[model samples]
Target: MEKQSIEQLQKICTQLRRDVLRMVHAVQSGHPGAPLGCAEFFVSLYFDILRHDPNFNMDGKDEDLFFLSNGHLSAGWYSVLARSGYFPVEELKTFRKINSRLQGHPATEEGLPGIRVASGSLGQGLSVALGAAQAKKLNGDDKLVYILLGDGELQEGQVWEAAMYAAHYGVDNLIATIDYNGQQIDGPTEKVMDLKNLKAKWEAFGWEVNEIKDGNNLEAVLEGLKKAKSLSGKGKPVMNLLYTEMGYGVDFMVGTHKWHGSPPSDEQLADALGQLEETLGDY
Candidate 1:
């Protein structure tokens, strides 16, 4: 993939935000908060960081791979994947619709060009990523494996088990990131179940940890990703704690969990569109 400048990537982020809002609103269902918050990360990964082929294959040999553990962010991932040429951007209109490849959560049954496995059932993405990373190592494929997880999903015991396994087995080719937006479907993660001192926790689990304090900033996300990549192949898995607002970009949606799974009304959608500039044109 061709590398993009920070300015260009930022523009893509705006378009992705618009896409997420519209996709969710069109179905009047689907989670939007995490997708809105994660626009920068998704754009930076697909457009700049990932050494991937848009011509998708399940084997993923000799190419960097990404998995979304927090699958509710499907809208944003679908937009990035489409814009990056994994599938037609026009298909985005059918998101969450009946029999559409773009399901509410990413699934492989439709053979979605970009998705490798069924996801959205939280707490399982890391394990899947670890398996892929270990396979790459076994095949002598140096490309990295990346996965994104929601901070709220950390409440799941499986994440910790996977964390222990990654470090114990020295899965140095893997990089896992937590969307530390602090909000989930119910309320604040801290209120629902506090993930106190996440950096300390990951480090104690024997992994190299990095953080992006302003995850919404495109430049910051890019820098953070680069840093995480640098830490790879050092005999331990990498973890990036990315702090972002649950609902970013749109003013009304920002800073609240209410929009986590709620689609905006017609007027709200119009207002969100007004806030986001259509940089690459709507799908």
Candidate 2:
């Protein structure tokens, strides 16, 4: 695929945001907050940053690989995958439906074109991404590995273990990003379980850390990803602490955890579609 201009990427993000709202509202199931919040990141990665092949190969021999640790955000990932040609865009309508490849959480059993492994268990994607990164090294493939984790997921002990392992082994070819939206299924992360000073925490674990203060902004996300890639292959894994709203692009849903897994009502969906432009047309 040809490199898209920043303007083009922003338009894709708008379209993707629309896709997420419709996909979730269609089934009245699936998570929406994180997906809407991470739309810019997903669009930037797939359409601009990643050197990926949508043809879908398990080995991923010479192409960049991405893993979604916080798999509840599958709606946005699936939309991006389809829009990027991993599968038919029309298949997005079947999200979370029986026998659909687009499960609530990404799975490999159905052989989804863009999914390499089942996710959504949280605190486990980093471990999987680390293994893939190391395998690439063993196979003499220098392509980078990327993973996205929710900020709330950092509370899990397994995440810390993988963090330590990656840093200890110098998994520098990997770039891990935390969607620091600060809201979880229960409530605000601070009210639930505060993740104090995340930048300091990741740096303390021996990884290169950077922050994108406004992760919802397309330009900021693109720049942050570029910086993260530059830090790769330098003997330490890179971490991007991306700050975004849980329910961005939707006025009523923003800043709240209520929409984490809640699909919008018919009226609510109409309002959301009003907020997001129908760029590139709906899937």
Candidate 3:
């Protein structure tokens, strides 16, 4: 695959961030921090990196598949899926509303185009992603499986169990990224549950780990993802410790957990939107 120009992908990230903020503000509910912080990574995957079909194939034969382990950030994932043509971008308006396929978290019952699993319970996404990766290998498919996780979610024992299993089974086709923003709902993850020496921990679990210094920066995120891809099939599962600000792009929201599940009020929304310039045009 050819290297994608960073400038073009940056433009896409800007629009995705806008979609995230708008979706949350619309319902006055949902998570904005993770989505905002993770804007570049999502844009990089959908537009510049992943070999996926937005035409929406559930089985996803011979194509890369992604799962949102930290599903509360559905705002970001839904927007990217829609803008990428998995569904109509306008449907983003239904976010968090009753009877909308775009629920508070990614779900399967509604048969949402991009969601393969109903996530957001956290600590279980890696296991599901690994299952898909193993299935791909068994079916003689070389495609990869990707899952995004939250740092705070890692506190769950299931996450570690899945981590150990992936390494034990040599799930080399799987790439799991942690949203290491340091903040969860209550406060800083360290204060909540410190994951000291995270890289060493993953390495100890027998997985190859890659670190992205500035996950919010498009270039760093793209490079880290490409490196992880290159390291695939090398004999171990890959983990990306992607460090990002809790609330990125939005000035007031950045670096705090306050916005984790809090949507902005009318006045705050106006201020937030002003900071995030329209890139691909609002939905």
Q: What is the TM-score of each candidate against the true structure?
A: 0.99, 0.99, 0.98
Model 2: worst 10 consecutive residues (lDDT sum): 274-283
Q: Return whichever of 2 and 3 wins on TM-score.
A: 2
Model 1: CA > 4 A from native: none
Of the two candidates 2 and 3, the one with more favorable lDDT, higher being better, is 2
In order, the Cα lDDT scores of the candidates are 0.94, 0.94, 0.91
Candidate 2 lDDT tens digits, 125-216: 99999999999999999999999999999999999999999999999999999999999999999989989989899999999997988999
Q: List the residue pairs that clash in candidate 3.
A: none
Model 2 gets an lDDT of 0.94
lDDT of 1 at 202: 97
Instruction: Candidate 2: list runs displaced more than 4 Å.
Output: none
Native-vs-model 3 lDDT?
Answer: 0.91
Q: Count the backbone clashes (under 3 Å) in each candidate.
A: 0, 0, 0
